[model samples]
Target: MEDKKKFLADLRAIWRGIIGDEGGHCPCCDRWGKIYPRSLNETMARSLVWLAHHSANGDWVDVPKRAPRWLVRSNQLPTLRWWGLVERLDTEDTTKKHSGLWRATKRGLLFAQNRLQVPKKVYTYNAEVERFSDELIAIEDCVGSFDYSAVMESNT
Candidate 1:
């Protein structure tokens, strides 16, 4: 039980570091235009599902690998690989632009098949306002996306 709890906690921490609390948020938007969700939004989930369906039958899959435009444009799907859900196949050439095959890992398969349950959205916690909410906070709650460089080692 303790180990499972620890794993989930560590998951959140790693994702937070890899992504970030204010992922692509407009710091200048003073009016609190919208506090984006801290979980996998519909757009991202759809994209992942698309990948899963195309790569059915456990076959190695190739895809047009590019940082998704909507994710960048909407600031939603930046740090996807950090979740351990999807991975890039290693090609011999290292110095090349992103354009190749990527596959979903076991965890990603679980997610795609709905075996793993993660949160949908988490509310804002403004430290400046000294406020918090404790409804059903889960590991999937995240703000923004980043890369492996942002990964934080879990203190296990």
Candidate 2:
């Protein structure tokens, strides 16, 4: 019985470490720390544009199966969230088989449409700490039509 209780406690602790808090916010954002700034790459910007296009009608969209592996494999989606460009739905994953739903933010749409001017670099923060880390990156060009072919062609 004691071993089972300890195992459950360990699971809870691990959950807290990964999920941070109930709102899905990371430790850095929780403290309102400054976000780190980094150069945006063409591939990521294009991905955001793609997201903006799909979620334009204000509907949450699933990450396409054919999406660039780097988007999820490399954690670009979370990076987008750091820039206030994309957001994930906070629904519980009871089956624990799917990643979750996502959508573009209003800011993201404007940026993708070339109406909003963001820095060539964007601010990002450390997910585990309340301070900005140099590893976070942001956006760049997203001009042209809402097509996934361009993204698919990229070598990333």
Candidate 3:
């Protein structure tokens, strides 16, 4: 009975992001979910840095406020989320705010601030199965600070 209760509690925590049911490499091939440390591209790097600057105070940022339409349509947010750099606001209060809102994860802020170094590459996996996708690579020049001015300049 105690074990069952613990299991149920853990299951509930998954959706809350308190415990992860996703993430971790395959036990057979040992390649899925493998993380590599490659540099980020200018656009991706700038996006992360910019997000970090805005969300450093743990505030959620409006995604579409100044983002280019093309960028919004891109996989930037998903990619960042996959890399654990950013997260979508998922709380009861989320419905009160704009749907397109996000915030940087602690690791994201650290990486954007040049305080943390993460893998540059990672493999996609689906339900313990490795997906047929290209390995991720970091941008060539993403090791420095990217401020508001730089983000705006890139948009122009």
TM-score per model over all chains: 0.44, 0.52, 0.52
Question: In candidate 2, where is summed lDDT lowest over 10 consecutive residues?
Answer: 147-156
Q: Which ten residues in a row have the lowest lDDT in candidate 1?
A: 147-156
lDDT of 3 by residue, 5-103 (tens): 998777545532321334454444654443222334556666777676667778888878866565566647656665678898765765564366787
Task: Encode model 1's per-residue lDDT on 5-74: one tens digit a residue.
Answer: 9988886565445334444333335333233345555566655554555454455555544435553355
- The alpha-carbon deviation from the true structure for residue 99 of candidate 2, after best TM-score superposition, in angstroms, is 3.3
* Runs with alpha carbons beyond 4 Å of true place in candidate 3: 1-40, 68-70, 73-75, 91-98, 127-156
**Per-model lDDT:** 0.47, 0.60, 0.58
lDDT of 3 at 98: 35
The lDDT-based order of candidates, best leading, equals 2, 3, 1
| Decoy 3 TM-score against native | 0.52
